[model samples]
Target: MAGTDAAPADSATTGPVDRAAWVALAGCLLGLFMQMLDTTIVNIALPDLTTDLRASTSEQLLVLSVYTLAFACTLLTAATLGGRLGRRRVFVTAILAFTVSSLLCGVSQGPVELIVFRGAQGVSAALMSAQTLALIAALFPKARHGLVFGIYGAVAGLAAMLGPVVGGVLVTSDVLGWGWRTIFFVNFPLGVIACGLAWRRLPQLREQPPPRLDLRGMALSTAGLFFLLYPLAVGREQGWPPRLWVMMGASAVLLVLFVVLERRLLARGGAPLLRMDLFGSRRFTVGLSLSLLFFSVFAAFFFTVSISAQFGLGYSPLRTGLLALPFAVGGVLGSVLSPGVVDRIGSARTLCAGALVLGAGLAWVGLTLQPISGTMSIPAVIAPLVVGGIGTGLFVAPLQTAILSDTSEANIGSASGCVPTVQQIGASIGLAVVSLFFFGQVATQAHSAVPATRAELVADLQNTAVEPLFRAPMADRFADCARNQLTSAHPDRPAPGCDGDPSAQSGMAADLIGKANGQLQEAGRAVAARSFVGAFQTTLWALAAMCAAIAVLTLALGSRPGPNKPE
Candidate 1:
């Protein structure tokens, strides 16, 4: 059922040099753009989805996590199917699936429906992702691959940057009453066009003799990834109950079984979807580790910063999205320099330098968060982000190249899918883990600092525990409190007779009313500021640890893979 049994349909490899190649490239790039953009686009739109769908915080997390889970699980199979069924066929099918699913996502009436549709989109994404690099490799001659890859990297960086912008514009706009749905609905035309172009222009290479699909391995991997991801995604929201523990246990068992299954498949002369032999190459292994760690760092950064910008700093989604532009700018600079740095300084050194810069950026972000608030200066925050952007730009392409360097050209699809899959898994884990740290910090701080006598403290704790629910209102309150409390020189000072409750003083004295209200508000604001600062500091420390670990792993990347050398 799995392997390609016959040569690819024998179409001429080269046709008249015309607009065909150009069309093909554009289509592929469009497909790539949609795929990558979807990964982050939903992030900015979560607030809208929550309001429309009446979804809980946990449900929104499922919406994001499920897509990633499905993508990660199916990637290996998708890669194999591309080779066996014909890359163009698989590519078109994927685009159509993604397009249709996206439409479903937009039309969905509830969280469950939206999540299901998103999962379908993820499946479509996996299929398309499997073939992109292979298609690119087939389209360009060997000598031109470096340039092709460079262009591809740039496209990816652009898509990532554009996601927030697209989401922000769509959500802020009133046209068609689109709101968040515009983000999903917009993909329809692009996907259809890409599918059409791919069907017509893609070259047909002779397929090799049929290879076998490892169904057992596929099942094991899927089950294992789901198991691992489910807990990471949902545990924080649900407070890691015993039932969740069972799922986590199951994931561990299944993963071990998956590894064992893969080994057995390799021993049986079956082309195990993943060549276990690849890991023997130290560079490839290290590269993968760095990929996982680096992506985890980025995931934590984006998640934390997104929440902080809106929640801590009280910025609009549009403004926050605009503020994030510097990361992309940095990425562009990094991409521009990747080739030169790789050629001159060597890929390893360039990557390490990027990591160091990223570490510094994170350290700056951590150190600079102020208890006082005047909308954290745009340039001050962007400075660190630019560092991260440049570092990521340096790291992504070369790291990928190094990881895949040792992979047999035949299994390049596998390596391509594998690397991104690992990165996404790291991302999902980081999001979940960091959320746990963030909310946990909030809860812990609330418990320790908030007073037992204040009924409001209970609400605050619950709010902190489920703070992800406070899309805007609670965040605004928190920010207002911090701003007023930090800047106010005499928050608790009463106006003349302000000491007594306004209700008690109502019949007796008008002047006491204002004073009493002011005193209570001041007290409340002080409590909130302390709690907010505690949560803020705690989350920063957690992010710092994650980033620092990534920095260490980045330092471990020994060297770049020689061109065409297996990692």
Candidate 2:
């Protein structure tokens, strides 16, 4: 918790919640905002990145996963560092690191470069974010803690939901034609100013006599998560080779070892990496699981929808954003309404209702996409997305209340710390699992599109007023070429002059081929669209399964709500 052991300005001169404290709080929120913004910003940009960077499906997934993976890995270590070196000092340094990395990310020339820099940004984000809560705990008086935390909650909620809308606006506007780079570049000024404000306004926090960091514990934990996630992110691309299996096994073993090591440390009278006892609470464990499960689906849903909209349907970035606007709007309403829902029913029932609603909405979206031959309409997309959003809010809005409602005060700091960790890790895991299905379907549907396209090509050729001999060969040739281009979201441009058929009319061969090409391309797009739609359907089912699990787990949480907890 970023060295909570420290005294904040001795609490003598400034008293609690001073002007400087408020400024510090604002700086921390800005820092939090940036991190949250980056998380959502990339979802909309994925399609653009996929095309512009020539990045493979796996690589594109990696770009999204790497940041979260790095963020999760570094969290314990960053928080520990904040404890030892002073939270404010470490937080400021991280801000500088985050800013510089954002600059590098903006100028990146290739996908590989972008991935590496994003990891750097994630690390900085971890260090910077770890301290914000600690600062809040230090600055806010007990009387006002709930209020400040409420504001924090509000910011976190908005940040989580607003990313796609902002990303759509940014990418659509192109902001000086900078394209996706503008998203990262937009961070530079905000980050710099936040850093300055933080350094000037934030107080230094030093643990009395300082604390020793468990480097061994940190390494074991990091290795375990890395091994676990690496294969998930890359395994599909490499066809899940033997080495990947080895990595997965090693990851499990390492995680087991981490658990053993933490237990031994706690038994001995030394600080452990993460407190093992936190898992002892049945409510905490179940709540953590539910949080992870929900967000995992949450993260993948946006990416899946974004790709479906842009690649599958041929919508501009702006149109894609507009369709999704309803989802975001609905989420806001859901967040506002979730408390009453929980109050009217119970946390468990509220959660269950939300999950089921989300599932139904997602099913609607999938069925809606099934009939789509090309380009999904905004009206069709809006209703289901908005319904799904409300369900998402219903599930999301009550998560913390159900989980932390039973948490002890001593564990509150740690509980607060674990929330995002669990959510992000779940997201990382969900995206990896979904990618396996999503990309696999893309390949499957692309291949499946060939025959449908070939038939359409033959019909188009027959109606073209072209000769039968030329038409037959031309359709066959176009089918072969079109099939080859199915892996791409777009169709390959057709070259003039068909092979064979010497008696064909001048330009007639080209014209017939062109007509076939348009359908063929549409067929490819339809396949890509259909594949994405298919994946989303399965993802929704998976999400429903998770919701069911949540309902079951809710049985474990104590029904009583805390005084500070939301209904």
Q: Which candidate number maximizes TM-score?
A: 2
Q: Write the per-residue lDDT of candidate 2 for residues 348-402, one digit (tens) a residue.
A: 7777777777777776776666623543556776788788878877777666556
How does candidate 2 fare on TM-score? Answer: 0.83
Cα lDDT of model 1 by residue, 474-521, tens digit: 334433443343233222222233333556555424342343344345
The alpha-carbon RMSD values of the candidates against the true structure, listed in the order shown, are: 8.5, 5.0
Clashes of each: 13, 0
Q: What is the lDDT of candidate 2?
A: 0.70
RMSD of candidate 1 to the truth, in angstroms, is 8.5
Candidate 2 differs from the real structure by a C-alpha RMSD in angstroms, to one decimal, of: 5.0
Alpha-carbon local distance difference test for all models: 0.68, 0.70
Residue 289 of model 2, lDDT score: 81
Top of the candidates by lDDT: 2
Residue 38 CA error for candidate 1 (Å)?
Answer: 1.6
> Candidate 1, which segments miss by more than 4 Å at Cα?
1-23, 203-207, 372-375, 443-556, 560-567
